[model samples]
Target chain A: MIDIELAFENLPPWAALLTAFCVFMGAFLTLTGSVGLLRLKTFYERVHAPTLGSTLGTGFILVGSMICFSVLRGRLSVHEILIAVFLTITTPVGFMLLVRSALYRDRVEGNDNVPEGNPTPGKQSAPDAAVQQD
Target chain B: MSASFLPADWPFVVLDWSLFIAQLFLGLAMACAAYRLILGPRAQDRVLGLDTFYVNAMLLLLTYGIRVASTIYFEVALIIGLLGFTGTVALSKFLMRGEVIE
Candidate 1:
């Protein structure tokens, strides 16, 4: 096993403190998000839970990582930024697709909990209503 | 060593304690997500649980990398993030269209 003391002996006090703070916050947020996911009743509510992790949870952790590595190597290590960017860009898209698909399936199954027809204005037509009816 | 910038021992102590606590929280998060995945009443709930599990796992990996002072795990964590998102997208697509491909 790698010795923790030996590995981090060179870590400055400020950097160590920052890393600890970031990691702690990140982990706490993730845990809260997961707990929310488990406790929420509906799939739509649950869909909102993981966003906590994908957003702030991921942001804090990646920032902590960047700080730790940059301080340890005595050089800027910003590669973890890639993860933050990728997650920020993709998470909403994924969630949007998932929620839309779930709504579509629910509507197709005639689940009354979800609103039927185009709730949007300027797009109401008999053919669309007919398609939904059939 | 840039330890000259902050010559103090308290931060290291704080770091050790916080790292342990963070790991504990992350583990609990993973357990919660697994519970949802296993006990979900609906398929979408299971998929949502799985997505949460992946994100938690990736965060856990980042903590592990910090603990070990290794950057290799960063790449692994990145891959997990990318692949996890892709898997969820595919799963959602399959659910929506009844198939992944047209």
Candidate 2:
């Protein structure tokens, strides 16, 4: 069909190749992040794995998709850009909050693995104890 | 499909093969993340697993878009990423503050 030809013809060979490469790379990174998430021994360490996929992997794939579509469409298709921006802004916040909460819970449970900070009752200093007593 | 569309020569074929291999590796990564999500000792670990899953899903969507030469896949990927981020934040807040409603 002429329509099909027109669409296929519009895509330059290099663009197609690049798109494929980008897609592969994106998938590869995501896969690696998942693997890292599972392989890591701790929750804190596990959090780091997904970021690899979220940050650079998503970036590369989005760019590649944008380029492929823009070139093929012969126009700037930027809706995907919004999603990218949203993810970038939110992923970190989510990760930080989750980490903080985990820390809080661990501390509350008196888990030995959590780092030291703001001593709890019975673990506080004399001045802190006096203040608490009052 | 026309002969021209079939892609001439062995080199391009080799490239495609390599790219396929790359995708396989990425898939492996997703499996790893899933394993962690399922095996984690705590709820945080599951949340982390889900977060990683979302990131990986986004990338996977991109790859599908590229393979199919469609822009729609990219949009889906973006949405997944956004949802993943929000969901992770919510879960974390619940874990930390003990109240997701707030």
Candidate 3:
């Protein structure tokens, strides 16, 4: 096994404590989100569960990583910030698409829980036209 | 290498303990996500589970990087995040329109 003590040798006590706290919080949030995903009854409700991990869980972990690297290197290593910004930008878009897609499929199948009407109005015609051509 | 701010004894121990615990939590989270992926009644649930799995895996990598004190892992984590988002988007598109591309 790799020696972990060597890794911590350069980290200050305050920085180490802060990093530990953030990492622990991130891990706890991720676990909770996963459990929520497993336990939620409906697709709509379950869809929200993973956001905890993608957003705040990711945030905490990235912050911890930033701190660890910055302190260890004795200078700001901000590259990890790129991951945080990219994730924050992309996750919501993906979730929106997935949730809308799920809703559309359910609505097309005649599910009553979802609001009536096609979710994508403009694009619906293109698909129908494709079917006609075939 | 930079000098440690703490006197080295207790803080290092605490950091080590926390790292181990964080790994344990992340592992359990991945298990939960996999369970959802396997047991999901619908495709959407499976996709969501897969997404969760991806996020958890990324976080796990971050923690592992911290443990090993390597910057390379950050690049790997970033790539995973990008690719996972694209995959999820494509899958969602397929589910909605019956095709990934028109």
Candidate 4:
């Protein structure tokens, strides 16, 4: 039953253990990232959390899967690289856009703590402005 | 049902146990991401949560692929990866520019 059946049956003990280690480590890293996402206090801080899973966590899992399939089929299976490349390429772009957008929004609404960005209208010129609004 | 899935020997036994562990962790991680998605204070935080959710889900599928010993799962994972990127990019673009296309 080629793919539908249990293919790991053909894998050797060494490769099986290696694959297991890789997959477990990846899952653990991903869990750590999720924990970080939940525990971080600020938005910017939270933004940093998911990257752990996306980068190294995904990397490890893909590697493990590659090894598992390669050993199973008796060939070098590396198509999982498509997912990896997409992850590496798109994660930073999306995050950069999201963070920049978030920053723009915060600045537009006059967050004085954020460094000035072309002074777009609502500058919150002084702490008095922030206080007076309250 | 369970017996059919179990391997006949030891090395594969280690793998089965590890796959179980990996699945458990990934599921919990997905829950954490979902929690953030539902409860985040801001729209950006929600988007961030959504991003993490899809990535975790993709990896989950990959592990499932290895567990089932199917390359078909790779296609599913690839689709998720592609969709995840497109969705996040569009949402973030909308967030940043206020209009997705303009």
- Candidate with top DockQ is 1
Interface RMSD of 4: 1.7
- Chain A only: list TM-scores of all candidates: 0.85, 0.79, 0.84, 0.80
All candidates' lDDT scores? 0.86, 0.69, 0.87, 0.86
**TM-score list, all predictions:** 0.89, 0.78, 0.88, 0.86
* Residue-wise C-alpha lDDT for candidate 3, range B10-32, written one tens digit per residue: 77778888989999999999999
User: Which candidate model has the greater lDDT, 2 or 4?
Assistant: 4
DockQ of each: 0.72, 0.50, 0.65, 0.64
* lDDT of model 3 at position B29: 95
Compared with the true structure, what per-residue lDDT tens digits does model 1 show for residues A16-81?
A: 999999999999999999999988877877888879988999899899989998989999998998
Deviation of model 1 at A43, angstroms: 1.3
Q: Regarding TM-score, does 1 or 2 come out ahead?
A: 1
Error of 2 at B69 (Å): 1.9
Q: Which should have the higher DockQ, number 1 or number 2?
A: 1
How would the candidate models be sorted by DockQ, starting from the highest? 1, 3, 4, 2
**Which tens-of-lDDT digit does each residue in B1-102 have in candidate 2?**
357756554334543564566567666776776776787789888888878766766666566555556666766776776677778888887886678886
List candidate 3 segments past 4 Å from native.
Answer: A1-3, A115-118, A121-134, B1-8
